[model samples]
Target: MHRLLFMGTPDFSVPILRMLHEEGYTIVGVVTQPDRPVGRKRVLTPPPVKAEALRLGLPVIQPEKLRGSSELEEIKALAPDLIVTAAFGQILPKALLEVPKLGCINVHASLLPAYRGGAPIHQAVMDGCTETGVTIMYMAEKLDAGDIISQANETILPTDDTGMMFEKLSRTGENLLKETLPSILEGTNERIPQDEELVTFAKNISREQERIDWTRPGMDIHNQVRGLSPWPTAYTTFGDENVKIWKTEAMQTDSEGKPGEIIELTKEHILVKSGDDTAVAITELQPSGKKRMTASVFLNGTGSQWEKGDLFL
Candidate 1:
């Protein structure tokens, strides 16, 4: 049995850890980020990976900083044959990377050389890519710029949002990791270099990135909404409050109105004009201090406030 050190922090990483444990991998230690204060109460909460590790009875460590930390020394003492990281949320130090005999492997969400950062799954959907995949790669010092050991591609459906893609990619990554591990141990895995020219990045989505620019093309706005759905959602200003748009569809009609102008409002949709004579029909939204609601439900309660010719900034 090969000794392994698993490092990850989010719910996305939980399934992979579970799969490895169920398969009887000797997970000598699990390293994750520390508990974070969440929600209105600001209660400290453990990450999903930490919760899962506890359930599995795996030894766990939550290091504030890996470089020059006592936890790093503890991990080195574990003498893991391999180190696997999935969305660990921090870069591993070169010293720790060298500790694993079989070397470090990362299960990245995007196909190598493209969408190579923390938010690849969201980037693929926002950019309207027809396909994206998981990449098992040898960990390099640079961010996700590693030699690929294996990959598994997935199709991006028209209706797939960031939430949907996350679920799909999680399963895809789990299977690919399992399939590639034996070859990695046997030193038979192919390490194909990525084409630097084809590389693209998916940097972390900030609050600014989540703000909807109504001046953009309708499809672009639609993609932005879906990409950020059920998260730091795409938002536009309405009166004195922020209105988070959770679902939208691009309309190809010739709607002539100022950008951000509400051209039409019905029980089912709130059509907003955009640049290039295009429009976006918002189906789900959340006003500031309110829960997410369907367009119809919101209209029933606030119909008088939302009218045609109103502008959303």
Candidate 2:
């Protein structure tokens, strides 16, 4: 078995770490980001990877900066043959990369040269791409520009949201890691450079990106709705109150109402006019300072104000 140091943080990286442990890879230690404050209590919490490492009785390191000479010295003393990283937030410096005998390998969630940076899975669905995949690459100084070691693709379903796509791609990446490690250890795997011209970047998502642009085409609005679901959800203003849109679906209509105007309202759905089409059936929502619930639930608390003819910013 090869000696390895695994680095990861979020839930997206957990599956691969579990896979590596089960495969008996001799993981010497795990490196993850320091705990973050979360929830109403403001309690500091260990990241998913740190928790997993603890559960498995494995050594873990939570360094605020890997570039610190002391941290680098500690890791180098382990004499790991390889460093495996998946969604570990910090950029790895060249000084640390040289510590591992076989270098580092990264499990990125998109087909390289395509969504090549942060939030790849979310950007893929938001862009309406027909397919997206995971890539296992040899890590380099640049961000996700390394030579590709292996890749696997999956089709994107029409109803797929960021949460669902993330689940799928995370597993796809885990399976790819399991299959590729053996070959890489034997020196048979090849790494190929990414096509520079085809490169596209996915910057970290912003709150502005979650604001529903009603002036845009219906499909574009719909994509944003799904892409941001369950976190920093798509939202708009209604009657000077923030209204979070948790779900939406397309509809055909000839109504010429202005964009952001509520064209119709029924017991089951709310039809909102957009640039080129209508968005019927926003099924769930959250009024400011309230928990998320079905549209019907929201209507009960603030009745009739959400009805037809009201404009949502």
Candidate 3:
């Protein structure tokens, strides 16, 4: 068994670590991002990978920054034969990348030379991409710009959200890596250079991107809502309060009013006109400083304050 150092830091990376253990891989050590304060309570929390690594009885290292830190020295001491990373959350330093004899590889969420950055899955859904996939590639000093080892495709269903696609791609990558690692260890793996012209980025999501742009088409708004759903949700301003839109459906019917205008209201949903002359049905939302609720709950409760013609600003 090869001495493999597994590095990753989220729910998406858990399955890969589990698969390695289940398959009886020689995982020498696990490297993950340091515990950070999370959520409303701001309590310190261990990353998903760290918890899993501990359960597997593997030594774990949590570095605030791996490059030029003592943690890098600690990782080197493990003398891993290879380093496999999945959403490890930080770029590996040149020194660390050169340590492993079999070299470092990543199970990236997107296809090579496309969506090659931190938020690939989220960006794919936000762009309304019909398909996305996983790539197993060598880890370079550059971000996700590595020689391809293997890949597997996955469909992005129309209703799929970031959370859903994240799970799908994570599993896909796990399987692809499982199949590819054998050839790599045997020194028979193929290394295809990425086409630089096809390179695109999926940088981390920002505050500005979370604001609902009512001027866009219904499908665009719908994709945006779903892309950000279940985390850092898409939001719109109503009066002085911000309402996070958790679920919305693009309507086929043409708009009956100006963009952002409340075209219709019922117990089940609120229909707002979009810039494409179509509409979106908002069925789930969370008012500022409040828990998420059904559209009907909002309609009968505090949302009753607004009527047709009110703007979703």
Model 1 worst lDDT window (10 residues) = 298-307
Candidate 3, residues 174-289, lDDT tens digits: the string is 89988998899999999999999999999999999999889899999999999998887899999888999999988876546778999989889999988886689999999998
Models 1 onward score TM values of: 0.98, 0.96, 0.98
- Candidate no. 2 TM-score: 0.96
**lDDT, candidates in the order shown:** 0.92, 0.87, 0.92
lDDT of 2 by residue, 1-313 (tens): 6899999999999999999999888999999999999987989999999999999999988888988757777878888999999999888999888887788999998999898888898898889887999999998898999999999998889898888888899999999999999988887998889999999988888989988888888888888888887675899898778889998887878988888998888776688999886565577888888888887776666655666788888
Better of 2 and 3 by lDDT: 3
Runs in model 1 with CA error above 4 Å?
none
Worst 10 residues of 3 by lDDT: 250-259
Clashing pairs in 2: none
- Model 3 regions lying over 4 Å from their true place: none
Better structure of 2 and 3 per TM-score: 3
